[model samples]
Target: MSTPFDLAATDELLSTTRAVRKRLDLERPVDVEVLLECIDLAQQAPTGGNRQGWRFVVVTDAEQRQLIADTYRRVSQSYFASRAATPTDDQTGRVRSSSDYLRDNLERVPAMVIPCQQGRPESLPLAAMASYFGSIIPATWSMMLALRARGLGSVYTTLHLVDDGEQVVAEALGIPDGWTQTALIPVAYTIGTDFKPAKRPPVTQIVGVDGW
Candidate 1:
């Protein structure tokens, strides 16, 4: 059967949405309307039990952005110190380079997106933990895809959550007590939207037929 949609464009959008960092245009102002539109699209993503618990806190204020950036920087020092000592393959090396660049210039990025869920996964049972976070992660990814489609770029960052940083950021942002942050995303317009699909190992090596 033939499908009505443009599969090539769909695949292109899916494949080319890179974890953009260094190429992010830090100086460009991301319009609030566009960001909201993307989130509106994201809200259509399926949620666990249809709780619809996703919430996004968009930080565009200079002082708040700096504070969030500072918190991230403080948490990353030891991480980078250890990462520097570890050996990396070609792909890992590029990621590390971009991560370092983002870390240094995080404050200058125009908007920071903090995605939150309704409840804390840490205290939930294993199954519930999965269910709790399963609700928001897809919507977050959808948000990224929508951003890419609109000539914007973002990177998912959980580095700050390593050292009570989430609590600090929540306090800084005045987030309510019950909600838990899932990730920190830096959002900006890309310097260019010419991202190509990333290289990966052949599917045959990773995929199994009916069973592994």
Candidate 2:
């Protein structure tokens, strides 16, 4: 155990956990135990009613990955097709183009992780939506952080839910009926660990005082 300093490393990890895409090393195989460890940590995240109803579906089979990627592409293409581009800013233009590339090549990724929440019988009150999603997103971030520390990279994408047919894809993957598909994460060992934080607006700009 090389324990000279720990919290510093953790603070660094949280700050540097990047949403890696092209850097994901598709050729290397990821160990199951590593992913499980991350999942275990994810479970500790809060859930609605402390119900802990989230389910994770992992797809590693070659054929299954193909189907999933194909579905994602179909839906993503349709979604992208509908959007109009305004070259108003460099970042916006770059993001739109990058998304197109990711959608077109998603099939090449090695693994897919789908995070689902247990379906509630009735629509939740609008006021509770924040807390409801809050429970699952933290755990998801935890998983990504764990993966980054272990030399892996993943991107959270939901466009895969479009014409790609999430329901059919779910059935093909044997995901039980009620596990709602909240998001998908493609996993792979990253080629490099030298990721930097993304460019973004200052936190103060978005954060509001107690009352808006």
The candidate that achieves the highest TM-score relative to the unseen native structure: 1
lDDT of 2 by residue, 116-188 (tens): 8776423778757666677778888888888888888888888767653778788898878766777889889
Off by over 4 Å in 1: none
Residues 1-212 of candidate 1: C-alpha lDDT, one tens digit per residue: 59998999999999899999999998899898998999999999999889998789999999999998899999878999999999999999999999999999999999989999887777789889888888999999999999999999999999988788999999999999989999999999999789999998899999999999
Number of the top lDDT candidate: 1
Stretches of candidate 2 off by over 4 Å are 1-7, 120-122
Model 1 reaches what TM-score against the true structure?
0.97
State residue 70's C-alpha deviation in candidate 2, in Å: 0.7
- Whole-model lDDT per candidate: 0.92, 0.78
